[model samples]
Target: MLTTAPFTELAAQMTGRVVTASDSDWDAVRQAFNVTADLRPAAIALPRDVDDVVAAIAYARAHGLRVAPQATGHNAKPLGTLHDALLVDVRALQEVAVDPAARRVRVGGGVKWERVTPLLAEHGLAALHGSSPDVGVAGYSLGGGMGWLARKHGLQASSVTAIELVTADGRFARVDADHEPELFWALRGGNGNFGVVTAIEFAVYPVAQLYAGTLFFGLEQAGAVLCAWTALLPDLPDEMMTWIKLMRFPDIPDVPAEVRGQAFTIVFGAFLGDEEDGRALLATLHELGPAVDTFAMAPPGVLGDMAMDPNDPLPYLSATALLDELPDSGVEALVAAAGADSGSTLTMVELRHMGGALARRVPGAGARATLPGELGMFSLGVPLDEASAVTVQAELDVVSRAVAPHKVGDYPNFVEADTDARGFFDEDTWSRLRLVKALYDPSDVFRGNHPIPPADVRSL
Candidate 1:
């Protein structure tokens, strides 16, 4: 049991809400966005501003408790019951400022993509954001954010110009390429293992709108469509990006009749240019005869909604891998594992194209600036019961094994819970990350998702 003395004093110093296990709202405060993360921290503290965050960190240290800073908890699957830590909730630190003339945006720790994208749209500018609008900006960008425009502009982490963070020693510091250069590099793609980021400033493009949407086809054509898709990757223009998704709908009554219990193959695409050019470039896909096509010219915000990601939280298991190449053989393996004929419990299998600008690593950029693979493959499994969970787990295992030969590394954001951080980077990059951790947070005060331990403490 955790003593209340330090918490009591901490509450007196904070101008924010502090919920303990004894509070009436403990159940709600302790739960993460993903239902699977039933975190039971000693206490949950909501920091309203930068000062409050510093106070919370100091109080945790004073009481021999670590501070696990989280904003929306969207990627909290790996964080189990945090009984030994104080969960610092940064949702109340919502602040956004845009320099339209400079083509940059400064976002708070709590701001979501939905909130920031529309704001930038007003100025005829846009930033790189994830598929879901509900995902927190700071957390997403910190893990190397990938979006529809990534092929042209590169990862979001590479665009970061500055970050305001409260270090483990309770000091507020501004990190940029010239200031705290190593820490700045680590913070951009370093998984937020060193400090609590209060705000971040990143570059945005002068794009107002683009042609984006999905082309849907019945599952029977999945094998042929996927093979063609793989063949087209090498010829795609830098201004465009595409991904293929194979989804199996459940037989639940709530599902629409058109897709209930049936599988569908979707070819979703986005291009950053004029409508006429976009259509002309995508004409080959139209010749393939999709059952339905929803592609059209729309605002950049529409990219977040194109995937139809769940707006609310639920229990699910997800895994991802980076592939050095997605040849015909790899596509065939993907189809056999989760396509029409496979009685799989997995809900979705997606292959996102990587390269173009992603292949060019910026000089003096962060650890994630370079693309490790040509494609990123992800799988999602939703289980409603113990038996269903077992089935989904089995299918996921089979899917992983099928693509094992093509696997290289993995994107930090898409990696599963309990996965070692070493796989996300090369040997030299991992060593550099460990050294940064040792210098900034030697005691490992913040062991958040995909943690990188201090260098000297490792078992060599």
Candidate 2:
């Protein structure tokens, strides 16, 4: 446990409040997006601005404390958990400024995409932010965010105009493609390995709304839907992104009577272009028999309902794989493992179609995506008891092996909890990342979320 005595002097010096277990709000502070991450951090420092973050980090460094930088807390993560940890909550750092003329948005690390999306919409523009509006802008973008408009704009990170980070060694640096180039490479997909990113500026797209939402089908029809969906997605325009989801809507009156409480296949899509062309593109899917057709013009805020991903944590565990070829054999393995009728207690199996604009990389994109195409990405959401993490991992291991022939760049998100920061990047990638980390964070700080594993850890 962290003693308050040693840090009382330091706490009195900062503008942000320093809370400990003695505070009545300690329970609230300990709560994470995923309830599984129930940990009492030694100090919860609410930094009101970038200067506050600097002060908090300096205090941590002075006391040899571990610092975990967080915003929105939506990653279902475990990077900052120790009782002795210094929790740097960046929520007060929220800022969203749109350079409408330049087609860009410079969002503070603490800002949620929801705040920016609407502001951009006012200018008849939108950034390719993730589905969850509750998710932080900088945190998600740094992971190469994937979302509905992703195909049209490419990786969110690729849109980055600049990033401002407080290096581990306690120096503030603003990096971009042209300046501090090495640090820029690691920031894109290196997770939060190098330092605390306080602000990020990325390119925004002109988009108001789209033909988006779910088209649901019965569980029995999942196989047929998957086959047809895969064949149709590759022919899609760059302005559209498509995905197939196998899920079971809960039995509740709030849910429509048609899709409530039954295993179903929901085709969720987003078309970034005009409506008429989008409808023509989706004519084939519209022909398919759906129990419920919630597909229509919708705002970005409600997009989460389409995926129906739980906002609250239950016993959540998931594993995913990137595929090189979505051949019949691979599809067969997928269906057998987590299909509609596969009684594996899995909540949903999602197959996201990649490629399209995704193939075009920034001049020197950080992560060398091993698999590049308009074909596949796998997501299986399973909810079982906490004790079943081992069993779920074992089952997922089998599934990963079954599709090993298709392994590509791992999703920092899909399998986040399963792999530590070390395993997130491959050897060559991690090696290059370490050299950059050493250059920026020479004092061995930045050991929080999506951390750069130690030189020893990365080498192994």
Candidate 3:
């Protein structure tokens, strides 16, 4: 059995603080980015550096406890239970080093997109970061990050040059294409299943500015907007990417006054080109006469805030799927499920255009080299209470059913629930991932949001 006495000794060997249930700040220390997640771990270790991470892993192993490495916990809902696990919070490992000349960046596990995007913009460079700037760099890249530049540059995982982590055996190692190649592939998309990642180095692009913005239409135009957007997908070039969303903005102080308490069908996009070409590409969308048009030639930093993702934690339920296609019928079904008169209280129902660079596998790509789909559908609802939760879930189900016929596969990063990790890979890929798991973490000392068991254990 575990006790506070043993933890005291373990804490002495580390430079950072260790918080147990008895600590006064236990509630704060154990909290996840999703307020709905109820994480009750055996203990929480706040690591300050690589040595601290090694110390935490050693302590967990000696005490016969599993370790779960977490940063911002954006996907913590999938962690489920951690009764016998030590939650290694790596938020204190905030290190950012950018090489402007080389177009490279090395960041700590705790670093978020918000911390680096503006800085990269100053150097006329940008990383393949997602809509939400608050998302951690390590977790995002490991789980196959997709963003505004995704269709142009592919996934951020492919850009990863190296990963520095402490293995399950409490040994520090760096894996890349030249060293521990198989392990390197697994870590890119296998998430935290192998070890506690301390730092990651990746490549960035020399992009100072781009033509990007949004077009907002009344809720009544949802059906028309989606139909036009679907037709426009085939002609869009690799340098351009777009997403259409049905959003019902809440009436709150945090929300912009102009959009608060309003519902709209929004079309947002980013293009790695000049204004004339970008505007020509979106000429069809402009003909619809949107209520608001904010398109302009903006700096790369503006892409970070264009999505307007919530800055604070909120209780919400979400669903996602990779869609092969969204025909006219699918658009009609979607409008009937979540449009103006559908009676859906869901906060957002979005469909992101996929393909272009996202469809091709680069030379040194990792496990998640390419996502197989032309469109990615994501829907979510904010549930404030038990009654609201039920309504939100039912509406989400309806929206999901509408697009069920076109689903090709699922993106592991967007899958927010506990599920078989094998579903994310092919038979050959699954076998190799398990083999790598057996070689490095046979005991399964580390647990990721989507756990991948070793081959030996699966055979048993």
TM-score of each: 0.95, 0.88, 0.98
Writing each residue's lDDT as its tens digit, candidate 1 over 188-235 gives 788769899999999999775588888888887888888888877788
Runs of candidate 3 exceeding 4 Å displacement: 1-6, 457-460
Q: Which stretches in model 1 have alpha-carbon errors above 4 Å?
A: 1-6, 251-262, 457-460
Task: Write one digit per residue (lDDT tens) for candidate 2, span 232-330.
Answer: 876888778888876766676756686677787788888865667777887787788787777677655454335665555444555676655566677
Which candidate number maximizes lDDT?
3
* Candidate 3 lDDT trough over 10 residues, lowest sum: 1-10
Candidate 2 yields a Cα-based lDDT of 0.71
Screening candidate 1 with a backbone cut-off below 3 angstroms (N, C-alpha, C), the clashing residue pairs are none
Query: Each candidate: what lDDT?
Result: 0.84, 0.71, 0.91
* Candidate 1, residue 271: how far the Cα is off, in Å: 0.6
* Runs off by more than 4 Å, candidate 2: 1-6, 252-258, 297-306, 364-405, 418-428, 454-460
Higher-scoring candidate on TM-score, 1 or 3? 3
lDDT for model 1 comes to 0.84
The better candidate by lDDT, 2 or 3, is: 3
